[model samples]
Target: MDAASSLGIDKIGFASAEPFTELKDILLRHREKGFESGFEEPDIEKRVNPELSFESPKSIISIAVAYPSKLPNPPRSEPGAYRGIISRSSWGSDYHDVLRDRLAKLEAFIAERVPDARLMSMVDTGVLVDRAVAERAGIGWSGKNCAVITPEWGSWVYLGDMITNIPFTPDTSIMDQCGDCTICIDACPTGALVGPGQLNSSRCISFITQTKGYIDDEYKRKIGNRIYGCDTCQIVCPKNKGMNWTHQPELQPDPEKVKPLLIPLLTMTNKEFKEQYGRIAASWRGKKPIQRNAIIALGNFRDQSAVPILSELLLADPRPEIRATCAWALGRIGGEEASSALNNAQAKEQEPAVRQDIEKAITAVSQSASR
Candidate 1:
């Protein structure tokens, strides 16, 4: 624990490597309800049993690193200069790298004590459920928002863990503090939080933003100005009120990159996108999803000034998702130029899906103009 504290780990706890029986049922129900985000490992046995990760695993060590919640001197978003926000989780340098480095250091420290100590470490990509491990290891209680909430740091922390052959004293789990609190569920824009501690990932704006295809029209307006993940559930949680952690320097947000101008993002090339957002976690899905979401944000803002660039994208952009989203944005902006662009796109657009999008956008613009 002393070594972990010295290595800048905010919280650490140990747990027995016994199979997670309770989680299996929960996950089974999650699958039955079609709530999975498709990011999880498909094999349920590997997910529930720590033994699958390592031979003779006796204990697991869970660690948490607090990340910053607030950005300093954030750029202002006005009518002409609309900006889209990347969630707090994706604000800093990729947390996977940061957490992996810390875990490697922790492993080295343990190896020094137990020569020939066998260990397997993992971050978010690992098959093991991080929040489940953290909860069992007493790092924090799982919140109704599905976040592991540490009393000291709220839910603003990155989690990682290691499975080890060495037996260790298991810490007691924290008592649930989300009693009678329906704030996160009530605040969900899309009603993705179906119940306490339950999430319908299909409707989650965070998951919706990461999807590659054209977003559903129903969710388009609800996405608001989020370019990456949505933080509405976390922001509304009472436990997270007034909680901000800025201790880890690597976790601090670069205001401009995290909250960037929406207009510039539409025309960004692959190389340009990589150079700017390559190090952040949100860039994992690449530029397509982000660009698509940026177009949606422009529509949500209804910024008439964006109509020109959006019209250009509708005519010239090669990606159907981009072209289609631009049509939607232009329709929302609704002007003579925007309507003309949609009509032109309807005439020339070859892809059936994109053509339908153009037609729908034309109708939307016509309806708005009528009002």
Candidate 2:
């Protein structure tokens, strides 16, 4: 085998199918919403399991691509005002695109060797519990943040899996190295990491970013300037400090997304939003969530400069959710101008929830205007 194929080890033998018998029992619990099995969908059980055989499927090959980057510190004096905190993983192109391309290439290599091979690929898909499989395959141990942590890559890597009829040798699973470190749990701003190796998705900033509508005014204030994803837990982990890794160049973000200026993202048109974020994982939530997040970040920044943009969103956006969030942001921004804009928006808003938000904004801006 050539060097690339040799490194990927597509020719290795499969772990015995019998060993995976227990996997089904575990998957049962994983499909539940509150479970950490990482299986997000209920239907996945029918599609993948020990019983489902690849016509020639003999082994599963899993690959991990490290995504660690040298993160710069957010400005400390007014920590929340700093807009530099892009989730290190998402600052570039979507990892799914990068990992999928690499997996396809690897699958081709395996197919070249085994002509009749069948391949099923998953990278962060609902079908397979990626971290569990990675642990079983000996790639890394699950860290307290619930992310797989490789000794070399730290916890900053994207995982990919390919199941083929060709049996390949399995890698040995590694022992947990967390060693009682509770750094990730402590670092979570929202207490999302409630315990070791457990995450409450509802409390996670990353999850919040994916959600649309008026988040609790308090929650929006806590969200800081992160418009996409949050990486505070990962950032504080000792393992990830100063680590960099080999990344697929294609997945790198557009320069604008690297550390987006909050002002521009709020003003992006539907066409512009699509043009900029359409291909990214963040885009799955649509522009509304992102725009809402930008508004919150602007509120957190307390930069009156964002007042005009937030005001425009308050009036121009058709989505009641956006209107509500903008109202809240204007409240947080607190100025005579902000109050006037919110008051005007409140007059036109038909939605009760939005009208309430406008009232709250009026209250907050009224308070800020007094100061």
Candidate 3:
């Protein structure tokens, strides 16, 4: 504990490197139900068995680093000048890098004591299910929202794990404290939380926002101004109500970057996006998804001022997805500018999908005008 505390890891727990039998059953059922986001590791067996990752693993070390829940003095998302929100998890330096460094340090510390120690570390992108490791290792219990709810950090902690050959004493597991609380389930904007702790990632706003291609109209409507990820479920959780972690300087958020102006995001070049957002976790999908989400947010806001910009993108944007989303946005911000742009693009738009969207947008604009 002293070594972990010095290494900047807030919490650590040890669990026997046993196959996640129950979790495998749940995962198979989740896959059968099409609940996966398609971003998960394809090999379920490898993810459940730590032995597959490293030789003769005796225990898995789960680590958690707490982060702030609140965005202090956040920028206003007013009327025409609306802003898009990035999830709290995406704030500060890329956590993947931070967690990896911490894990490396922990591995070295363990090696000092156990000369023959063999270790393999993983962040969220690792083969192992981070939450399962954390749960078994006693870092925290899996909440109804699918987050590891720590006693000290609530659900506002990042998770990572290390599979090792050391036989460390396992910690006591924390039981679920959610009881009958269904607030997180009810707060999910896109009905992504299909059941307690069971997520339908296909309908999840967070997954939808990160999608590289065109977003479904249903999800686009619910995404609102969330440019990167959704936090509705976490925000409403009783465990996270007043919890705020600020000790780690590297994890502290930049207010402007996390809650950036929607309009400016649409115009950012690849280079500009990289320079501005390269350090953050949300930028992992690159600028396209964020730009696309910003476009959707503009439409959702119905900011008439954005009509000119969105109209330009609708008429001349190189990317079909961008053009299609602009068409969708223009529909909501409909006026002479938006309607004229959509109508003019109808004949010129070559992509069948985009053209169909333009037609739908035109109809939406016409209906709005009629009302």
- Score every model by TM-score: 0.99, 0.86, 0.98
Whole-model lDDT, model 1: 0.93
Per-residue lDDT of candidate 2, residues 1-371 (tens digit)? 35444443222212432235455665554445464423264555533563353444566666777664753343342333335345767756677887787778877776888887888887786366677767777778889998988777787777877776666676777899889899899889888887787677777888878776668765787788788788888888898877775444554545446567777776788899888777777777678787788778877887787788788878988888888888887888787888889878877888899999899879877776677
Task: Give the range where candidate 1 is weakest over 10 consecutive residues by summed lDDT.
Answer: 1-10
Candidate 3 Cα lDDT to native? 0.92
How does candidate 2 fare on TM-score? 0.86
Candidate 1 per-residue C-alpha lDDT over 147-197 given as tens digits, one digit per residue, 9 for 90 to 100: 999998899999998999999999999999999989999999999999988
* Clash number for candidate 1: 0
**Best by the lDDT measure:** 1
**What would the per-residue lDDT of candidate 3 be over residues 1-371, giving only the tens digit for each residue?**
78798999999999999899999999999999999988888999998998888988999999999888799899998988899999999999999988998999998998898898888899998899999999999999998888899988899999999998888898889988999999999989978899999999989888888889898898887888899988888899888878999999999999999999999888899899999999999999999999999999999999988988888888888999999999999998889889899999997999999999999999999999999
2 or 3, greater by TM-score: 3
Count the clashes in each prediction: 0, 13, 0
- CA error at residue 238 for candidate 2, angstroms: 1.3
